[model samples]
Target chain A: MTARRFLSDLSLTVCGLAVLVFLLLPVLVVAPMSFSDAKSLEFPPPGFSLRWYQSLFGSDIWVEAGINSLVLATISSTIALVCGTLAAYVLTRGAFRGRRLLEANFMAPMIVPAIITAVAHYIAFARLGILGTFHGLVLGHTILAVPYVVLIMQAAIRGFDIRIEQVAATLGASRLTILARVVLPNLWPSAAAAWIFAFVLSFDEVVVTLFISGAHLTIPKRMFAELIIQVNPTITAVATLLIAFNLLALAVLLLVSRRGRLFERGY
Target chain B: MTLPGSYESGPVASQTVAAAHDVAAEATAVPARRRASLRQWELFFLLLPMLLLIVLIFDLPILNAAYWSISDPKTGALTLGHFRDFLDSTAYLRIIWRTFFLSLEVTAATILLGYPLAYWATKLPPRWRIVVLGLVVTTFWVSILVRTYAWIVILGSAGLINRLLMWAGVVSRPIEFLYNEFGILVGMTNVLLPFLVLPLFAAMMRVDMRLLQVAETLGASRFRIFWQVFFPLTLPTLAASAILVFILSLGFYITPAVLGGGRVPLVANMMDLLINRFARWETAAVVSVVLMVVTLSLYAVYQWLREKNA
Candidate 1:
């Protein structure tokens, strides 16, 4: 029995290590390929060079697309955060008829297949004369992203004790004052989390963007177009940079929410 | 001194008058407090923008898609020809089968590997557990495009694995790893594994460690304790994660498109081809409708079973 148990444990460890390597190998491969000296995608590099990184920086299309992605993500995420927080506040604090229905509506976007949503948006926006515009893209992405913000904020609000707000109101504070001073401070971690999540959702979004984006090009859309037209190492450089940026964002989020125990709660 | 009938009548009328006055006062006070509570209507008013945006953007678009699926483009009349075309074709049927099987394979792989990792995580110290889980969830936040691209770089001809194998004399020739079903499976599994792990970890954490200790004291072997006590409790989470992964995998397009290199076709890829290549919007809409119905039915079944058990 002891020998069998030992063998099983050993096997489990081996399996775990193999899985980890599988997860990490692709990421590991890209980091070096981004620095390859050759113009073409060849492994065991003929030599080492940073020409791809230089090309990535020098290209006007790449620069414009990067700026476009950042602006769209930032504006859309902020809009989502504000709208979602308001909806979350209403859901948590206000008593109204059909509250359950409203909550379900907020959640529907997240649960429904995103492809269906993308297709629908494509058809609707095309007819409305807004297709391919930055405004259309931002509006579409905000709708896609707001549900995440609402979800996180709802969880955050559940942990809050309402009695504190009641006490502030009883102590002669106005409703707006209490919200601004007491509620907002306590809700910061969730709000920050929601904002970050919204930003990432917008940044990473491709399917919906593919449908609505006409002349406007975001980073993902540009990369996709390039992939179909030609194979280039610039994409590897861009991907490496994105990975770094995501890691940075994750680190910052962890630092801010460490004390709040936000990661412990599941969405 | 007074007459008995007159004195009794006066006292009875006075009591009745006082009771009527008290009832009117209570009714007036109730509405006043209700009016005061109505002051909080601002919250709902604040929620209006979000509601309107969702209605216009999300609700209307989906309804349009459904309508378009039924509307015939050529005849300008409502018809079911697109649906019939999709259902009748052997090519489409095969594509659907391949998509379903690949998604199932990926889901199974994710669960088989993710479950043990989650279980092991529960045995670690709390701080280490958080860090490890953080790493897993962080992977979830990485863009799917980036991850898929990374896989391409690793699996391409003369890529990392091939190069390493050749250097180590493991094989004489580079293997055809990319642009195949095997590549899609590998990439999709990596992309979906984090989704499985998070939910499973949550489920595993709910199983009380003390219960396992009790089993140990009762002379059950460690393996038996795990199977009889731990595994049964985590079954619901396992089921939930499997459904989530499977459904998400069904709609997956990027990894398959990049790695499959046009050999393997999924429902999403079919939709793309119909719309872009064939300019057949009606056919694309039909395919989308089918995908939606399949996903929703599976979801409904899962929910019904869960509710019945509850």
Candidate 2:
């Protein structure tokens, strides 16, 4: 490369690396703090220990909340996946009236603020006498997550060939049979992507969970409550574990979908 | 007209024609059955879950919030006292202005920082592009609470930046980075950077490389080509990201609460304080309504701009 081009490239690399560091620094800061031996939050701590993590694991409240979060996320993601995938199929494949309106309604949750949704759900569930229940939180989260699933599944379905299904219909196969055998097989990657996206949305959800989940405490809510009371490192330990889980999940997803061209397919 | 063939034919022939008509009717009815069944199943299985959710959670709650906002507590009379209080109080109005300006500032900062990073990412090879994009999005996976705490550490009085500055003899004392507007801005920008970057990157990636090359072939300078061609195409993405970041920033609670240390109160914080601390659900409801209005207006503005540009 010419000197000018080389200099420009070097500058770009430096800037890119700087941005990366800026993004990573906050996350990296918590790792050391989580391991701090001191009671208060101290950087470059006097010593390192696993006391905070141990404490987090030993606490019943923390354990229960963690379990609650996992179960809620699992159930909600499943609901979102099923509903979103079906809607995606109908919207993408079927030539139906009001399809645009249905599609827009499905995605409305995403554009609305989570807090508003939460408050709305809180009031509605209260009137229905389901407020503060796990079922309520699950229902709310499923709604929040459906938009993501629909978006991902819609993208996946767009790449599918309608002619394949048509061919199946011509060859003595029922439409249901074609959908079961041909369409869903090709939809696996999108389904998996939707599931993962839903999982993350539920797992990280806080604003809505705060209002709707009256007595129930999901992990994020627990962490927020703890933060308000004190600057606890146990929360940090939870965050550290959550961050690790995210990375591991992302890694596994990347591995499994290696041949799927996920980003190119618009999930 | 049909009587000639019927009368000439045997009883068996007539029976065969009847059976053929029956078979044809069955074939026609079968497809109708299948179509109806599929439609019924789609409505029940595919659409019902989301529809029920929207009705019970989304539709009802919004209506209730509006109702709660208007209902009067004293004498069980309907009144607009909550909104009156919100509009009447200087403190509340100031809080509203503060929240608006803070969101605007954070959005501005994110655009300024994120655009260059996104532009740079587009220049890299595809593999590297994915890696960079992943890195940017991975930040999203990290909880906002943790990100805020990280900022506190970095911007705290005896924190990383201050300590480094002090050690480097750049300052004599630790600066007040926390519990102020600057601290909130720093934290908010850090959290919102990815929102700006992703959309901007999406737009920048769509720019035709050949266009820039052609400009270069025609003896246009790199800066001139970028200014005249590339920048104009990226404006819509910039506007979209700005709207997104601003709306997200408007609903922000945790970051400002932690970093501002109660000095900077956004609308979300006001809602919390009113509901939790003051036992003023009416007031909280009013604030929530106002916030919804603000967010919706911003979204409307974005749509309008997009339509006009189109």
Candidate 3:
């Protein structure tokens, strides 16, 4: 490379690294600060302690909220996975009129702002008298999460070949039998990724949860409430833990998807 | 389940009418023999649970919100007065405007900062490229709540920057970095950066470096080649991420609330105020309708642009 080109490349690399530093800044501060012995927000702690983690795990509200989030995410994402995968299968495999329109309608929830959905739930759940109920949250989150499931499965189905199912049909296998024995096995990896995607999306959701859920707290709602209610160090500790949890999840996903080569084409 | 003629009656009776109507109408044009193979009924059964979930959970409830926006409390009659009330309020109008501009600013910032980083990753060796891209993708899995909390720990008055500044004797007192417009932007941009980068990185991978080589051979300066060739190639992804980030940022409630210290009232916060605090469902619904229209229309534009470009 020429001197001028080398100089320009050096400057670009420096600037890029600076941006990466900026990206890493939050995680750096939050993780270490969680280990601080200070009762409040302090940096470069005079001493270290596990008080915040103890607080996070020891508190009933935090534990309950965590459990609430897990249960809701589990139920909703499972519903979304089954419903959305079926929808995608039909959209991709079945010859039908207005298929494009159906696909668009299915994809709509992903783009629609969450607040609108939240307000919608606020009204519907109130009327159903399921407001603050776990089932109500499951209903709302399932709606929010289905679009992701459908979109992911749609991509997966488009890449898939239907010859196996056709061959199975020619062999006198029933449609249900073919679907169970052929199509689903072919789609399992995508299905797994989509399930995890839906689960994580629903887990991270807050705006709609705030509206539909009252008294019952999810992790995000609790964290949001805590941040607004008081700037607590425990929240930082909680955030650190959540970050660690998410990183672990991402690693697991990367491992699974790499083995399956699921995201080789572009997410 | 037996024949194409038996298409209408199902659990997802809502969309079934529309699909069955289409099928029947098309069936008349075709011969009875081909119609026997019609799978619209099977399709209907396949799509039933999903259709029902969407209708009952998402579609109906939103329609209800829209209904509550106009229904009069006394006689339960629909009216346009609620919309007028929303339009008449200058405070609400300003909040909406501020929300738009804040989102615009954040989106612009993300693009400006993220483009270079994404482009740089493309220039890196394959080994380094994976590392950088891995960092960017991993950031996505982190929840917004956790990221925002991280921002608080960093930006707090007694936090990292302030303490460092004080220790360096840069100032007598700590800067009030948290609970301001500046903090809100920093926190939002941090959380939103990964979104902008991943898309751009994906787009950048498709960029043909041979074109740049061709430009280099054709006597184009490096700056000229990048500005005239490389930049334009990536513009579509830039546009896509920009619109996406802006729309997502517009609906943001947590980061701005915690960082803005309730000082900056975005539309979502205002929506919260109207519905939760003041119990003004009509006004909140009107705001939601407005938000939905704007968000969806922009998304429509995004889809159209992608298709047009495609």
Which wins on DockQ, candidate 2 or candidate 3?
3
Q: Once model 2 is optimally superposed onto the true structure by TM-score, how far is the C-alpha of residue A138 displaced, in angstroms?
A: 1.7
Q: In angstroms, give how far residue A11 of model 1 lies from its true place.
A: 2.3
- Best model per DockQ: 3
Residue pairs of candidate 2 with colliding backbone atoms:
A120-B61
Per-candidate TM-score against the hidden true structure: 0.89, 0.87, 0.91
- Give the per-residue lDDT digits (tens) of candidate 2, residues B1-310: 0000000223653454455554444444446666656655654565676677666667667778788889886664778888888899999999989998999999998987798799888888888888788788778777787788787667777678887888899999999998999999989999989888876787787788899899999999777898998999899878977998999998888888888888888888877777557867678778778888888889878768666644
Q: What's the DockQ of model 2? A: 0.30
Chain A superposition TM-score, candidate 1: 0.93
* Models ranked on DockQ: 3, 2, 1
lDDT of each: 0.78, 0.77, 0.81
Regions of model 2 farther than 4 Å from truth: A1-12, A168-178, A263-267, B1-45, B71-81, B301-310
Accuracy of chain B in candidate 1 (TM-score): 0.84
TM-score of chain B of 3: 0.86
